[model samples]
Target chain A: MIDHLPYGVFRTPGREPRCAARFGDHLIDLYAAESAGAVEAGGTLRARSLNDLMSAGPDVWSSVRRQLLNRPPLDHLVPLSEVELLLPFEVADYVDFYSSEHHAGNVGQIFRPGQPPLLPNWKQLPIGYHGRAGTVVVSGTPVVRPGGLLGAGVVGPSQRLDIEAEIGFVVGIDSTLGRPVPIEEFHRAVFGVVVVNDWSARDIQAFEYQPLGPFLGKSFATSVSAWVTPLEALASAWTPAPPQDPPVVPHLNDDPHHGLDLRLTVTWNGVEVSHPPFASMYWTPAQQLAHMTSNGATLRTGDLFASGTVSGPQRGEVGSFLELTWGGTEPVELGAESRTFLLDGDTVVISATAPGADGGTIRLGEVSGTVLPAVI
Target chain B: MIDHLPYGVFRTPGREPRCAARFGDHLIDLYAAESAGAVEAGGTLRARSLNDLMSAGPDVWSSVRRQLLNRPPLDHLVPLSEVELLLPFEVADYVDFYSSEHHAGNVGQIFRPGQPPLLPNWKQLPIGYHGRAGTVVVSGTPVVRPGGLLGAGVVGPSQRLDIEAEIGFVVGIDSTLGRPVPIEEFHRAVFGVVVVNDWSARDIQAFEYQPLGPFLGKSFATSVSAWVTPLEALASAWTPAPPQDPPVVPHLNDDPHHGLDLRLTVTWNGVEVSHPPFASMYWTPAQQLAHMTSNGATLRTGDLFASGTVSGPQRGEVGSFLELTWGGTEPVELGAESRTFLLDGDTVVISATAPGADGGTIRLGEVSGTVLPAVI
Candidate 1:
């Protein structure tokens, strides 16, 4: 797919409202196609903004997908340079999960030598936490550093600050309270994917984490990629996962054949890193979804979930700064760059793709950002 | 403590402004106490709504505690039966943690075999998620289940549900961003504690857990205790923690002098079932706090923390019904109440007390509420 396609609310600088997806140097004006009867299956795509298209559900997403796949190219698509990618959807809610076995195990080794890396329940479930979606900003939006009130007992109060690069997923439609969508069918609930940068502070978390978990240390700004890649386009690349060790409790385990094969990698300043396969995880996304929903809560579209620190065991494959730097004990060398943790002006880029054995590849495009100086 | 002090604001039949806390049988009227020099160290207690007192910080809370703890002979005390316990503060942030080791391990065992109960990162850092504080209501306030568009298929729908009883701690002071407050000294940022009822819908969580942790399922509305307990009262009961299995990394470990042993119990319809002690947690409150600040985020007062499921290995000690009933397969039988999970009209009460090896326990009182049926 050489087309530079991006989902966004498109309107020419001097024209009426329209929803369009860009295709390499060109725009596939969805509204124009719908009006011209070229996109008949999903008549609902004729809306002014993508909200209607997004809310119309996955069937709409699929029908639109089919039309895009078959119809001859339309001339209405403006040049990629002529249009702006108005973020396709508003973030309803955001939640993050710590699923990186490399991260979990390494940290585990530090505290308890030779012990199993993850908690038993982790394999059975998708361990996750809720996040602030209102603060979820599109990539390119500048974020101001957040400040905190500190006790000035001895040392002059200010402490350490940091940043993290992680992948986030978006939900398309949600389920209601009384019914649960089964695990085998969870992929239908997925809307697309985004890149997330969850910034943090080492100081505040230490003090407040005693009885509860993180509060102020994370409530600040979080950045996410604007485009969401639909689950359908990526469906053909499904792959089986590695056998789970010790086995997942029966109810929580996914069918052996089930799971996605999204190849992901991060580039620091331009140094390419591992695009480890999702199959490498000790746990699968299906297991995580089933376990998360066992309690019967509803999921909504435009919601974001992060695979917190998706690091693998290899030192270079670690997903986040905490795992990459080993709590800042070792400095990381990214090609021409060498640093302990995320430093000012550092830029991190992450992207995911399904690299087919036959060389056909479909991917969740790159999410990149540059860190600015910490706000005083 | 015998005073049936219910917190609320009221006036005799048709009188002017009035605010009071349930104390034994007498309502310690703030209006009355302020005029009597009971609420002040200098001259007199200032008569105002509970809102005013909370915003004033430690000084006001100190003076009030002094008067309440003075114990002026039970015979001379007034009964709280005639007064109301008004809500005293507003919550700015609601943060919940899954800190119960029993809960962590039990669930872990189900998913992972022979693995350590908690993850390595969990010990070195605090795991938490933030929630909207606007939905937080004081105890006795009925919580309304939220409504949303949900489904697995783009347009399909569901109504699965669940519930959780938890403990909430209230922050008293505020911390700014980029500053770290050591866990040992985090208490100064705390104002007091409260009980919490965090309702969940299992169905919704399943479909949407991957890209985000929690959204509509946890965000709808969360109930919390209204009375803010001062940290000073719980100070005497704060004790060291039970040792961790694998020692934590040096940077994360504390001197072993300070983890509080808060014995907690929860019941559905007044029968005790979930009985996990805070002592069983792998990470202490101090450690959780310190982890959050490691990134330089600030801590603040009035911020609330919810302990994620506090389940232990024992049958009756499982924190949530999802754990106790094994995702609702094993029906949990209370004294005469059989609850596979929480049902509409079922009331869950969570009570916590600090056990002193040498003195009486400091308590966080209780968070109680009945599960109302989902709005059709």
Candidate 2:
């Protein structure tokens, strides 16, 4: 059986938040176990949030996970359905990177038809931009469609609402303010991965994203999986990445095992439509972390950086509606439903699985959200 | 005389941080004063940071200022030179807005010639993007030049480092997740103002700021004035904003006094270079705040959003080196030293003054940074 003890924050009806570890379909209450002298990891498990455990560093992270795995099920064991999950960590800064070549090529072709597919700097560096950290929510939170200045000078509800399915990496260690974290040491700085649904308002983004980057269009709400799959648990999923086309700089170059071989799936209204393969991504997480710190930007414990839409080569591998529908030129048919973009009352879910040590699959959980009408 | 009590965090050699306020040229230790029963406004002043005071709302903010103003000289008063100033508040989210018409026009002209001076959506919304909050430092911090992928397929030290002098506003009260804060209620949400130095790597920005916005080019460092001048203290500085060509929506359109009439000045080393007038900005701070939450994005207590480079429609009113040197076509003569962009060991300072109650100028202090050589 796969031994993936992903971490999360959960709570009962009116109880304080507690650190939890998932085993099969049940959750181990770390707080109650620690108090009962059954586990002796640290007091960090007693914290109301996962950020404290994240700040305890990788050594503690490993010890805690191992201890949680070896312990027998006590009376503290709770069913997953009985608890409510919250966002795993407090985000210090949220950054989204455009790393998938297939997604970038499709976006570039749709936006600029006659010109080159990717921008000149796309291949040279890991292109990213900061996003609203406070707006990030846990899975199951209802997202209200944003209302802003759309095209045709209309100030009303977003006409082109969409979702971007991607993988998000969270930082568990802080880096020095003026030093760069090399690609090899990315694991020391990063903690784990989660599924992220980067909600977007295409019309608002198109009209306002000129000189600056996307703001309100993507800031209203961004949903992330409540569970954080620790890096150590996913060791078996390590695989060789594709070779760099032009050869990246020395700082971005790393060992081939730095790449992850996860399979990501996006479902709309409970129907699977996209199966973007994480193995097809050109840039690895190690390279993304190295490029992020290359300019001496300090990394805090709760910082999050997401891999941009993970689209593969096939038609059903597109991650976002903009690419899946080819800029609304085509409509994606989901059995009895046909959609160009998302509509009110529509639900989107994203999940992923990685190779397990026993030749099985380690589920990374899912981040799901339903779109509500704009509160205008 | 104008008695402005700006708040900051400070500490002696071997002591914990304490809250303090500046009056004239001396800083009063509010923590010590509160302990000594010298001033009685609220318990928020006893904290180590200004965040607690900011969350205390406008009434508490006014009372604390008034109490500090009327108090007699305390024995805990320290000279400004002897105190170590830290960042006034913990930044939850940092956003920089392009609100100045002249700066936007000059940048547009230099970047895209034979096109309109401003983008089509310029006047429609306050264009802004999230920035790295973890890299934001206090005034006296030394900023290191960043190394990254530049043009010509070269990845090395940045050749064109620059600064954008701007005014920054800090949010005190939080807005609901899916609710918009009306323009008239902006004061209830915003706490204070401070001077900000948005450092830039022009070459890096030019190369990577395409499909996404600025990343490594601007994430290395951002410096801010240590002391935060409360908005209630600058009551008399309110002035009428420029009329909109096509009137804005009801949510953004507000009373005339929503404008701030501050005069911003920039200096290189010790020589005067530019003076950017805040009165000429097209959008007001209230309107910016309203637009930011228009899409139902939540606001946290320590959120900071800065006014973009405050350039006016004149030669000497440019705020950034890019415009002052006309995209490096012209060189700025700082007395005996001539430069196109910021050089290593060069110090840039930005300070401002606003209209006081007694018809005199009230000092807003300064935000200064010395550029260190690239650590490549």
User: Evaluated with lDDT, which candidate comes out highest?
Assistant: 2
Please list the residue runs of candidate 1 whose C-alpha ends up more than 4 Å from where it truly belongs after superposition: A2-6, A9-18, A35-51, A110-116, A145-165, A202-207, A334-337, A356-358, B1-128, B131-345, B348-369, B372-376
Tell me how far candidate 2 lies from the true structure as C-alpha RMSD in angstroms.
1.6
Q: Per-residue error at A300 for model 2, in Å?
A: 0.4
The Cα local distance difference test for each model comes to 0.58, 0.88
- lDDT of each residue in A312-339, candidate 1, tens digit only: 5577676666566776777677876677
lDDT of 2 at B130: 90
What's model 1's lDDT at B213?
44
Isolated chain A TM-score, each model: 0.85, 0.97
Note the clash tally of each candidate: 110, 0
Models 1 onward score TM values of 0.56, 0.98
Kindly list the per-residue Cα lDDT of model 2 for residues A9-85, writing each as its tens digit.
Answer: 99999899998877677888988877887777668878887898899998998887777667654667899999999
Q: Which runs of model 2 end up more than 4 angstroms from their true locations?
A: A72-75, B72-75
